[model samples]
Target: MRIGLIGAGRIGQVHARSLAADPRVGELAVTDLSPAHASAVAGQVGGRALPTVAELLDSAPDAVVVAAPTDTHAELIIQCCARDVPVFCEKPCVTDQDAAQRLVDQVAASGVPVQVGFQRRFDPGYRRGHQDARSGVLGELRRVHLVTADPAPPPAAYVTVSGGIHRDCQIHDFDVLRWVTGREVVEVFATGANRGADHIGAAGDVDEAAALLTLDDGSIVTMQASRYNGAGYDVRMELAGTEATIAVGLDSQVPLRSVEPAPLGHPERVWSSFLDRFAAAYRAEMAAFLTMVERSDPSPCTVDDARRALLIAEAVAASRRARRPVPVGEPSSSPVGLGSS
Candidate 1:
């Protein structure tokens, strides 16, 4: 299928590389606000770079991947759906709930397939854990701990306009916890501190935050989010059940020395590269999305799935602001979906 991409940013480049490498996608057409950036990416993939969204739509791509800035997400999705083109949009859908809801409604009314990019759901380790939790191998998941931290801080522009930490970082963990447990988050409480050594709060965003959620089954999930992981991009999760406790850390190559000099050999080490562990999952996710689109099968991650995740994120942010537990409604209470796991 001919696939057009909007945006030439970092994650946009990642999508371009993946699509270019994939066999299912026939052509890659990209557009960026900056002509030079678009030209650079198009050169890498031996594809044409369009100057405008109209020119891109004129190419008649079967699907489009919208990785542009947050504000443009809803509009781009609407435009793609209006043309009956399936869209793969990046997460949070839109920074605003009402607008996001309206766009989601439009997609459903148009009967166009729309998938959101929540890459953690595509992580192999995370998929294994979700399967285990669902198959009773975990024996009733009781608690989950998710840690998402970036290598370092982002620019003031990003911090100011990216819808804060909840939307940018913690939302992934929030969404994944719900998917892994196969339950809805009922309550959310969060707190954060953006102290010295960082100008994060100066841009009206938090550099660090933590959230606690209660699921429908009374299961609990604790999420820690930060944009100040000096080492590298780290995303790890530990799920504890009645029978087994599984821990997966992305950056395991980091050395850990024993305080007491009586450990086996000297110290412990781990593999820390996030991509090394998730590349296969990423490929699988892309393949699955394409396969579903080809066969008209339901996508595992739908537009409503993305919306529900964003709702919980919104609740977490509200909980932090109110310093209390915020209630998160079920799919029935809200116009969202809780698909079969």
Candidate 2:
């Protein structure tokens, strides 16, 4: 299969290597705003670099991977759909709610399978949790707790347009929460504090946040995110149910310590970033996309799935500002100003 990749940035580079290494991928073409960057990645991956998106698409690749900036996702996905090319796009298909809805409708009308990248859905631990929860092995999930913290904050300029922590960081938790539990978030109450970085506060964003989410089945979920987790990058989820309790990201490398007398030993090495933590999952998702293209299967993670997760993030952001619970899908009293990471 021939694959076209847009963008040559960090995530795009990751996808380039993944796609290039795949035995099924006979050809890989990449494009970016920086021709040099595209050429570098293409050289490293044994692929070819194209000068523009038009040329890459015109090359008639079997499928396209939209690993470009978040703001460019909808346009690129629509372009791929117009050519009946299956697309695997990175998350938050569109940050703006109305635009997301329109993109969802457009993609649906195009009859092209579009898979949104929420790589956690491909992680082994999260996949196990999803299977257990849906197969009744977890038995009546009672509560869920999720934590996603970065080792450090992004640049202040990024914060200014990041759509705040809820959309930028914790949206992963939101997407995985729904995927693992097969539940819809009905309401959200969120709060935040600017404890670590003055610039984050200055930009009207928080360095830390927490949210309480109510699921459609009355299960309660608590999520926390921080940009100042000095220890390491930490992402974990615990599901407590009537029959059993399960935890993900509880491996030997987890960046956590117990103060008890008989405590577990310190981690030998901690994950430094999302890329390190989810490398395998990223590869797995890309492989899944290729399989979908090969078999003509429907998208496992559809655009509408991404839209639902974005709605939850918007509700969380609105609740943080309003200091009250916000119903999912409710029109925000004020603009949520959805932005991407």
Candidate 3:
């Protein structure tokens, strides 16, 4: 299979390497706003660099990976679907709910398979949690807790356009929550603080946040996010049920330290970033995308799925602002100030 990769930035480079190493990908074509950067990535991956999206599409790749900026995601996916090419786009396929809904409608009309990147669904631990939830191994799941914390904040400029903490960072937790439990978030009560960098506060965003979510099945969920987890990039989830409890992201490299006298030794290496922590999951998601392309299967993570997650995020953001609970899927009740890409 031939694959066209859009964007040569950090995440784009990661996808390029994965696609290049895949035996099924016979050719890889890459493009970025910077032609030199695109060329650099293409060279590193033993692929060709295209000057523009049009040029790359002209190469007739079997599929396209849209790792471009968030703002470019909807248009790129639309363009690929128009050409009858499958697409695999990174998370929050569109920044806001309206745009996401429109993209969902357009993709449905096009009948083209487009997978949104939610790598946690492909992670081994999360996958097991999902199975346990579905198979009743964890009987009557009553509660869930999730944490996603970065080792450090992005540049101040990024904060201004990151759509705040809930949309930018916690959306992953939101998506995976739905995926694992097969439950929709009915409501959310959230709060945040600017405990770290002043620039984050200046940008009207928080460095740390927490949310209480109520699922449709009456299960409770608690989520925490941070841009200043000095220990490491920690992302974990725990599901408690009537009969059992399961924990994800409890590996040796987890950054948490116990206070007991006979505590486990601190790991020499810790997950410093999303790329480092979810490397295997990222690769696995790409492989799944390729399988979908080869088999003409429906997208496992559709634009609608992304829209649902965005709705939860929108509620979280509104809850933080209103200092009250916000019902999910009720746009009139939750007026949000969505950030730009």
Candidate 4:
């Protein structure tokens, strides 16, 4: 399987390395607006760099992974599908629900596989939680609380172009909620504030945000996302039900202090290498995508999954914007195009 990569940013580079590492993949090709950036990554993976999207398509790679910036996803995806090149797009399929639906419809009609990069679903911890939820261990689920925070805010430029806090950051939690519960979010009520940093406010984002989401089955999920945290990245959830409650978090990491002096000091758990976790998931997701491309197998993250995740994110953003509860529904009958970046 030959893989071509679009964009040479941090995630693009990660995917490039992961794809190359897969024994199933033969050669890797990469492209970025900045040719130098593309070449640098290509050098690391023993892959050539393409100058344009068309060139990459003309190369006839078995599949293309679109890891470009969020704003450019829709068009590049459409183009890849047009070439009958399967795509593996990163999260937030599109910043807006309407555009995302259109893209989804197009892909569905094409009968080609396009997997969204919600790699968290493949994480072993999350997978265990999902199984427990599905196996009735959480018995008649009542509530799910998700807390996700980045170590620090993104660059001002990225925060500006990113759809917003909900779309840019919290959307992962929204997707995780749906995947774990196996239920659709029917409505959302969200609240946000710009208390963390003045720069975040200037970047058109809230430093802290929370949402109360209701699933169609009367399941309630509480999601909290923060762009600033004093420590390393933290993503955890506690699912409570009538029978029992299960919680998963980044419990242990490096930078530990040991004291065997009978309650003299406490050990500090710090994860110095969080990327290792993500790398495992990335490899799993890529392998799944390759299998789909080879045998036309069902994708791990289908278009419907992407659409639903985006819907929940949009609902949360709308709820925050209007300061009222918002119901999830189909994008307006009037289909729309891309939003201004």
Candidate 5:
């Protein structure tokens, strides 16, 4: 299958490598804002770089993976949809709900398939948790707890355009909440702090935050997100119900409760970043995307799914700004996108 990749940045490179390695992919057409970077990545993947999105679309690849900046996603998806090209787009879906909804509408009207990148839903541990939730074994589900923290924050430069924490970091958490419980968030209350670094503050973003999400079925979701952690990148969750609680944990790069450490050459527990923690999910999501493209099936992460999550993030941001709980039904008045990395 011929594949076209948009954006040759870090995440784009990751996807490009995955596509290059897949035997089913016959050709890769790559493009980015930085032509050199696009050429470099395409060369490594044994593909050619296209100078523009128009050209990338003209290449007529069977499917396109958009790992570009948040601001670029909606427009790219719209263009892809217009040409009836299948698109697998990275998340935030424009960093705002209304525009995202419009883009989704356009995609639907165009009769093209578009998948949002919410890779965690494809993670083995998270996938199992979602399956268990659907099985209804956890009777009278009461609480859902999610913990996500990066060992280190991104550079200040990135924070400048990160669309803030809610849109960028907690988005995965927000997406997972819906995927696991199959419930709509009704309301949100949020609080945050900037205790980690001065740059985070200067970037007009918080270092850490927690939010309580009220779901449709009276179940509650508590999400904790942070940009800095001393231990390692942490991603964990538990679903507590009247009957029993199901727990899931991502293996930390760091060791746990070990009196005797490795004899030698032990790597630090610190994950380099989200990439290290969720690489397998990335691969799986791409494989799933390929399958969907091949079979003309609906995306695992639909445009509506992307819309709802962004709306929830907007609601949480609104709550934090208003210093009061906000109803998800009430759209966020604020127009600015999320904060730093």
Candidate 6:
């Protein structure tokens, strides 16, 4: 299938490489804010760099991959669906819940396939845990704990626009929590601290935050999100239930220390970036996306899936502000076979 990619930055390049490696991809077109950067990425991937997104869309690729930044996602998806081109978009969809809902509605009405990028669901560790929980191997899931901390905070400019920790980082956990538990979140309570950051308050956003959520199935989930850990990228999950417990992304390496070498030693060595940590998952994600394009299958992660997670993130922000439990709105209808854990 022919493919067009937007945004020739880091994540865009990642998608470019993944598409280049996929045997099903027949043609590749690229575009970016900086046309030169677009040319560079296209040259590397042996694609053509269109001067504008409209030009790429006019080229009539079978599908387009939207790897652009967060704020641009909703508009891009709307435009793609208008053109009858399927889309595989990076996460968060958009910062505003209402706007995101509109995009979901637009895509549905247009009957254009849209896959939200929740690649961690494709990661081996998370996939296995999700399967275990779904298959009743974990008996009845009671509690879940997810931790995701980057080595350091991004630039202040990045922080200012990132919609804080909930949307930027913990949203992945929010989606995973729902996907693995097979339940909807009913309430959220969140708190955060901004101490010891290289940039104080970091554009008024917390450097570290934690959230507690109650699920419809009566299970509970705790998410710890931080922008700085002094160590490399840290993302791991633990699930406990009636019969047994399970863990992912953390290792039991012999060397136990607070310096990131125990309970998951050398996670730093294994992953210097979130991109590194989820490389295989991204590849698998792209493959699944191609399958959707090939077979007219429902998207692996629908626009509703993206909006649901965004709603939880907004609820978390609201809870943190109110210093009380905030009720999340309606949970999505049960997803049967979307390959969700």
Judging by TM-score, tell me the better candidate of 2 and 6: 2
**Poorly placed runs, candidate 2 (over 4 Å):** 336-341
Please, what is the whole-model Cα lDDT of each candidate in the order they appear?
Answer: 0.77, 0.90, 0.90, 0.79, 0.85, 0.83
Clashing pairs in 5: 163-338, 163-339, 164-338, 164-339, 164-340, 253-269, 254-269
Tens-digit lDDT string for candidate 5 (13-114): 999999998888999999999999999999998999999989989988899999888778888888888788899998867877778778878888998988
Model 4 alpha-carbon miss at residue 306, Å: 1.8
> How many pairs of residues collide in each model?
7, 0, 0, 2, 7, 2
Model 2, residue 125: what's the lDDT? 91
Candidate 5 local Cα displacement, residue 122, angstroms: 0.7
- Tens-place lDDT per residue, model 6, 258-311, is 655444444224456788788899999999999999999998899899888988
lDDT of 1 by residue, 146-194 (tens): 8887766778767667777887777777778878778998898888878
For candidate 3, give the lDDT: 0.90
TM-score of 1: 0.89
The C-alpha stretches of model 5 lying farther than 4 A from their native spots are 250-270, 337-341
Off by over 4 Å in 1: 254-279, 329-341
Error of 3 at 301 (Å): 1.0
> What is the C-alpha lDDT profile of model 4 across 236-325, one tens digit per residue?
878999998997663454222345563324426454333643567887887888888989887888777888877777777666767789
Candidate 6 wrongly placed segments (more than 4 Å): 198-202, 252-270, 330-341
Error of 5 at 264 (Å): 20
| Residue 47 of model 3, lDDT score | 97
Clashing pairs in 4: 253-270, 254-270
Task: Count backbone overlaps in model 3.
Answer: 0
lDDT score, candidate 6? 0.83
Off by over 4 Å in 4: 254-269, 272-277, 330-341
TM-scores of all candidate predictions against the true structure: 0.89, 0.97, 0.97, 0.90, 0.93, 0.92
The digit string of per-residue lDDT tens for model 3 on 11-52 reads 999999999999999999999999999999999999999999
